[model samples]
Target: MDVAEENSEEALLIKQHRKEKKEVQAKIQCMKNSVPKNDKKRRKQMTEDIAKLEAEVEARHKEKLEALAQKPTEPTQVSSITNGVTSLDLGSEEPVQQPRVSKAQKRREKKAAQEKERDDRIAEAEIANLSGARHLESQKLAQILAERELQIRQIPSDGHCMYRAIEHQLNEQGNSLTVANLRSQTADYMQKRAEDFLPFLTNSSTGDMYTQEEFQKYCTDIVNTPAWGGQLEIYATCVWTGGALQFCGTTGHKYREQLVLPDINCHLEDGDL
Candidate 1:
């Protein structure tokens, strides 16, 4: 066939393939909609339909590849005789060229697709929480989350968010303290006033009071390691700065604020020590 005829046939085949694929997809979607979520038998049948549709799609893709392979690569040449003189003509041959895609590019595309899928799954899980919660509590929690979204500045949860947050606040006020420096200063203050905090330092895991040696080791870990800072570090920062710290927390229905002080007589919670 001529190049034009061949191209027209390929186009028709592609259009037919697309039409068939769409019909298969529509059938699969209809089957999915007809089956109730809890209907095991109907769900099984829907699964089979999905498998069939996938196979059909794959087959149509293979047909497209076959059509491309069958396409002519050589240009047609016409010869003519004029004034009783014969002329010879050679057909032009043009090689079919396909764009080359690097493995690195493919890998990057795959990674982006996987990351998008992961984010989608996380969003779906978060939405599922609303459906699973008690109605009143769900509505309350939703409202709290909306408010928190507006007011809260999220920091990285890399075991250093608390220290980083404090560092950022200080920097905003024209102070120059790194997270590491803040942690060290807090630990030093706690160590110097161990006598005050030791009485409140109880190990929740073991249900035993912290000995002086054990408390010292805990302080060392907080300063030297990238462990997450909690109430202990908060109070230590308060004492180290010679100021009281105010903490705001919410539990869906209520917002609570507490003033953490340097005084030993202040209320000492498990984490506060």
Candidate 2:
């Protein structure tokens, strides 16, 4: 076969491999979803099967690519007569079509982009918050706390600090809940009452309302991942339990005011230290 024919064959082979891979992936997803959450033995077997199938698919794809690469390359010329004139087309080739992105892949890419943009905003906000005035503000905050006879209770600086702090307060109030329990409960509440929380939540990067899928994903991450707690989570916690979260810190020139959750009322003084 000529070089053009070889290219066409190679593209066709790649397309076939892609189709096979996609079908296998779909089957794997179905298998995962079909299994009961508590069936450890069956889940393990399904996992093994999935891994085997994925390996087989990858091997087949590799073999096809290798076979295409090993094909002999040659160029041929064909003659055509038009209007009593002979013309030779030498090694002419068609452009190889690229694989189309699936909708799921597109969604994944969009979510990743949104996350990156949100991280960038958080970094910028952090940098902006670190100012020379912070020291003075902290001293003023310390004086206020001393006046109120309240001492700062330092929680561990781990990512779960927010949850830990909440748990500590709960324990003091005779409501003992672990951090994991708190996280799961908060995530569940936010998901079930998404409408109540979704209106107040906006995309930090886009300044637009969150789509249902995005909100669901956010809730899922909170439940399944070590996602850092923020305003929405604090609000969810307050709503889940008829309690309030008092936030105190420095904003700009003044000591950042206290924020009461659920009601979202801001008080200048008398915040939880």
TM-score of every candidate:
0.44, 0.45
Cα error, residue 235 of model 1, in Å, equals 1.0
Question: For each candidate, what is the lDDT?
Answer: 0.64, 0.66
Q: Write the per-residue lDDT of candidate 1 for residues 1-273, one digit (tens) a residue.
A: 566644554445544655655566556656665555554666898898788767766665666645554565333211111110121111111222334657787676556655555566756766776576444554664566577673446575456888888887788788898998888888998888787677777888987889888998989998887688877778878767666666665555675668877674454545544
In model 2, the Cα lDDT at residue 102 comes to 82
Q: What TM-score, to 2 decimals, does candidate 2 have?
A: 0.45
- Stretches of candidate 2 above 4 Å error? 1-132, 203-208, 259-273
lDDT of 2 at 161: 78
Residues 1-273 of candidate 2 have per-residue lDDT tens digits of 466654565545654655565566567767875565455667899999988987776666666565555566333211111110111111122223345658797677566655655666766765775674755676677777788797567664445778998999999999989899999999998887777667766799999989999898888888777688987688778767778778776665566555555553432232231
Q: What TM-score does model 1 achieve against the real structure?
A: 0.44
RMSD of each: 14.8, 15.4
